[model samples]
Target: MPLVRIDVIEHRRTSEQLRELADAVQDVMLETFAAPARDRYQIITEHRPGRIIAEDTGLGYTRSEDVVVVQILQQGRDEAQKRAVYRALAERLRERTGLDPQDLIVAVSANTRADWSFGEGQAQFLEGRL
Candidate 1:
């Protein structure tokens, strides 16, 4: 399972727009990472103005208030798959939500089975329930 957190500036997008953005990311996860159909976990947070700040890091590209920062926590994904997810997220978010590709920032983190407990304080992956 990949747990995703999407952060965006408050008052910039409507609730429907947020769902569309999340759906776009989910589509990318399913297509590129091959995650399970029901294994979707996403958290979308809207921060107050000036609460989120992102610099270009000298990439010569400027970001606007429409920035979207996505953090993905997953396991067993190779570099090629990660790259594909990034590209797909950018394209899909742009097409679905009108978000600028340059304003989309994605970061994927690696985790193991021991790191997750679906419920009941049980380690499902370790117990072979996953």
Candidate 2:
């Protein structure tokens, strides 16, 4: 399962818009990342203006106030899968939310099954409950 964290500037999107954004990302996770059905886990945080500073890292692209930063933490996805998720997220978010591809930054990290615990003070994945 991928735990997604979407960060955006405060007041930049309406409540409906935020829901659409999350749905778009979840679609990519399910389709491209191959996450299990009903396995959605997302956290959306709205930061005050100027709170998020994402430079292009010399990529020669400009970011607007509508920039979105998506961080995915999961296990067992290879580079090709991760790349597909990035592309799918860009396309889906652009089509669904009017977010510029340039304004979107995606980062993925990996962990082991022991790293997760859905609840009950148990590592469900490690315990074979997942």
Candidate 3:
């Protein structure tokens, strides 16, 4: 399995909203990648608006407002599949918050199946090779 890791750069998202974001990403993976609903891993980060800087043509590099960045890390998948999943992700975000597609940038990191664990000293997804 190619481990897909996601890093989301966001601007001042509420705690509850952050959780929703994680779930949304998981949903996308499950639907597009054909991953099981139980097979899930997501990380959500919230950043202060004044702290994060988004490049806008106007405003001369001001802080971003109401923006979310999603990073995804997954395994056991190819590039085409990964890109498709990302496109789906962008659409979901737009549907959720009326945000511009440019506001969300998703990049999937490819990883080997050897580096994953679900619980206490367990690597079930690894098929016990480790």
Q: What is the C-alpha local distance difference test score of each model?
A: 0.93, 0.94, 0.63
lDDT of 2 by residue, 1-130 (tens): 8999999999989999999999999999999989999999999999999999999999999999999999999999999998899899999998999999999999999999998989989998778887
How far in Å is the alpha carbon of 92 misplaced in model 2?
0.6
Best by lDDT: 2
Task: TM-score for candidate 2, please give it.
Answer: 0.98
**Winner by TM-score between candidate 3 and candidate 2:** 2
Q: What's the TM for model 3?
A: 0.71
Q: What is the alpha-carbon lDDT of model 1 when measured against the actual structure?
A: 0.93
Tens digits of per-residue lDDT for model 1, 9-44:
999988888888999999999999999998899999
Count clashing residue pairs in model 2: 0
Query: Least accurate stretch of 10 residues (summed lDDT) in model 1?
Result: 53-62
**Candidate 3: regions farther than 4 A off:** 1-11, 50-63, 127-130
Q: What does the lDDT read for residue 123 in candidate 2?
A: 90
Query: Using Cα atoms with residue i matched to residue i, what is each candidate's TM-score against the true structure?
Result: 0.98, 0.98, 0.71
lDDT of 1 at 14: 85
